[model samples]
Target chain A: MTLNTWIDLVYLLAAIGFILALKGLSSPKHARNGNLLGAAAAAVAIGFTFAYPEVRAHTLNLVLTLVAMAIGAAIAVPAARMVKMTAMPQMVAIFNGVGGGAAALISIVVFLLEAPGKPAVYRIAEVLFGVLVGSVSFSGSAIAFAKLQELMTGRPITYPAQQAINAVVGVTIVALAVGTLVTGNVPLLVATAVLSLVLGVIFVLPIGGADVPVLISLLNSFTGLAVAASGFTLNNNLLIIAGTLVGASGILLTRMMSKAMGRSLANVLFSAFGSVVTAAGGADGSAESRPVKAGTPEDIGVLLAYARKVVIIPGYGLAVAQAQHTARELADLLMERGVEVFYAIHPVAGRMPGHMNVLLAEANVPYDELKEMDEANPEMSTADVALVIGANDTVNPAAKNTPGSPIYGMPIINADDAENIVFLKRSMRPGFAGIDNELLFDEKTTLLFGDAKDTLAKLVAAVKDA
Target chain B: MSTGILEFLTIFVLAALVGNEVIGRVPSILHTPLMSGSNAIHGIVLVGAILVMGSASGAMQVTLAFLAVLLATLNIVGGFVVTDRMLEMFKPKPVERAPKASDASGDDATGSPK
Candidate 1:
């Protein structure tokens, strides 16, 4: 077979491989094999590309490609191996950003190589789109990684006219894009890329940390679109197919994430851009002045030991304190006493969807015991004791009770409906959304103040003694 | 080339529809791995990098192509490996080891679980 035919065949196989990978990824049982298939496809694609006649003709470039692959593996292997599960989101952000940056660079190089006024308008447009979207994904993802890693404050950082400033930057990028196409100015193209990167950073700065999962998915979509545009420039079929697949899925994921948060995509992206309006719950002086029922480890232990049914609510703070095992141990203790135990997990409980489930899974929590928000809410009413571990916003009553509250539309675990509520928290501070949990001040709720791990250990000991 | 572009457009639209349908049914539990998994798919841009590198005519073009190849490789390799690691953890253990009566004894051994 001719070299071109071989490349085409390999691309076809790779496309099929990726499709099966996604299908397999949908279920845990097949996820590992799906990943392996993708890796094998990538290997085939990369290996065949090296055997192409064009590549063979340029020995120096071939060496460079090999060296580049080596460097990539050198960094990727160790980073992926060593990163903690808690930091997985940031890892995804950085890796996805590099993919975007790569696409942008390819567009720049293509534009630089094109002879002046020789390319078709459609080709120029594709390159322009590729550079713009790719640059945005790169810098936007960098900012996201920084926020999630706590390199900077997780709160939304805004200033007066932040959106106005961003709008101006957006307009400048569009103008530069047009200029690059009309005049075939390489410098203008470079300037457009730089401006787009700045725009990406500005775009993400005002989105508070709580909404980062949505932002990451959004940026993932942008990178996918950018790759498709890059494929258009290169006239590659498999690239177009794979890229568009990612683009579509990423978009759907982003929308789902926002819906889960009970916020519109528009509001999540822009509402926090201007003056950060303190939510009504945060501003109301009621939460502070309300008499809070505080409980010690022994009190919580006694309550849990006597309860017939206990529901555990786990959240981001549980992951932050790395207390999944301790929480599980306490649950085990309850189960030994013949008290039923179930874990209630909110869809958007942790940094990412299903984040709490993964943490609980690592602790060997039984799959049957982990309940989705819808499944767990009904049981909350029947549960004799609701043990909340480092979770606030998801269980807050304001989501259903206060119309003026920012989180009013969000679906929460019905912890308030339970007979007794015990919250293991570090302090009276609000959750990621900067709003106090009104449930903390409820008459039935008792706060157990300490680190989640320490408090859970104490609770375990208390339950054992009781 | 125009015919090629049209064919590409057709494939792009079809793939997008397929992506939306396939991903719509994915359970929330696998969303993170799915995101990272698809993140690897776009790394197919490495093909473009290879083509660019092959035809690179100058020092500058070569440098840009090299970086593109490097970044794309990172996305592909890092994305797939990390996803596999995550999915592996999701697998159920052979036995749900009930929290032992001496659970505290194992605390030091499993210290820093992350």
Candidate 2:
């Protein structure tokens, strides 16, 4: 197969664009643009690929492709629109899995076509990779998706015989792949596919849900390499380049995700820990958090009107209820009353670090108004009213002293030290770490049992009325 | 030389290993910012996949390339949109204008300073 200089140049430009996008995405400020630049490059690459003589022959398949494309676009567009940002990792995994399946299928079809007898060893390598990586990526990703979506529990499904059986299957698959290489026995190829498929499922089965993102990213990298190997088999430059990029990027992303979660990638993959799904019926467990007796919205308004200072502590509950806007409104009301209003943000308050910041920033909370835990904790002791909105563990007193807890020894804001505490939580349920919060039971604390968004809305209305 | 490919492999492996270490140090406090920041890399992945697809031959290459492009696009676009929505969470409001001391029953029946 001959390669054209123009096509190579276009591919090189796309590669440069990818590099730029990756570098730009290192920070939030440039993330959006990074996406656009990368996307534009991809568009160029796609257009060039279709210019090839081989693919242009499918002139009539255009109509079927268009119809299918439209159907996919409609479903994907809405799903992409509706899915919360938190679930983006899972979505990426599902899509990556599909890519892997496609790469594997490509090689299978190419092998079936009967290649001219040359580069026998290289062909063998490609076939082994296409079968192994593609199969694992496909099934492993599907299981990861299931765990993320709660279709399967987040806990590791540990079976004593599991790893042993996987080893046996893994060896068998390798043997078949090698066998097919030596003598293109279709039976060996089929066996290789089946073994790989099962290996994919088993590989991801023990990966706990909490670590699904890492697995997804890693699998994604596998998909890229699979495609790259397939590209070599097909003797396509664009395929090799693009596959290399995806493979490389996926590997990098997986590492980054693992770091963010404070676990090693190896730990995530090999350990049968991390997935701790407490029952959901406990969703309303905040019943014990009954706010200083159920005070009417108007009563809270009365307190806010008289308060000399009111500080709001925002948490994942705040993010979950999507109440940042209303909280800001309440803050404005407090400010107008000659009350000093500040937002106390904990590092790990929401699902991820800086989660609260992103949410608050979205609500246009001034960077100065948001106080870090160290900054906020000192103020809470003196504040007249500490309005805790949907925060749990970061404000929990246990983390400060309990070394046995998962979040033990982690620094937390001293919301319990405040003059008068008002906790706005739906119930007394524990946070993601699956541990109870003693702060909810504090004597000075007022547990307002309701959705953070609704309760905050009521508070805003009452403040306005007052 | 085959050594060039080996060098590239080394760099790739190093990036992945280093990236993992860096992300592990990320406290949950940095979760949102971290994802937003790293998603830029995910975009790069998408672009890389697209470039690959453009040169890929056979039906399978076509499919993998397109699929990678689509998913990565969704991640980039969706990530930004969601971040915008989340910002709505912290918008400031008007200051509290009234001052009243209400009791436990929540019934503020008394009319105070107008």
**DockQ scores for all the models shown?**
0.65, 0.13
TM-score, structure 1 vs. true: 0.93
Q: What is the lDDT of residue B36 in candidate 1?
A: 88
Residue B34 lDDT, candidate 1, scale 0-100: 84
C-alpha lDDT values of all predictions:
0.85, 0.61
Highest-scoring model, DockQ: 1
Q: What is the lDDT of residue B82 in candidate 1?
A: 84
- Total backbone collisions for each predicted model: 0, 43
**What does candidate 2's lDDT look like per residue over B16-56, in tens digits?**
44334433333333344334333322333333343344345
**Candidate 1, residue B19: CA error in Å?**
1.6
Could you estimate the TM-score for every candidate? Answer: 0.93, 0.71
On TM-score, the candidate that comes out on top is 1
Model 1 pairs in collision = none
Question: Model 2 over residues A59-94: C-alpha lDDT tens digits?
Answer: 433333334345544555576567665565566566
| lDDT per residue as tens, model 1, A182-216 | 87778898899999999999999888777788899
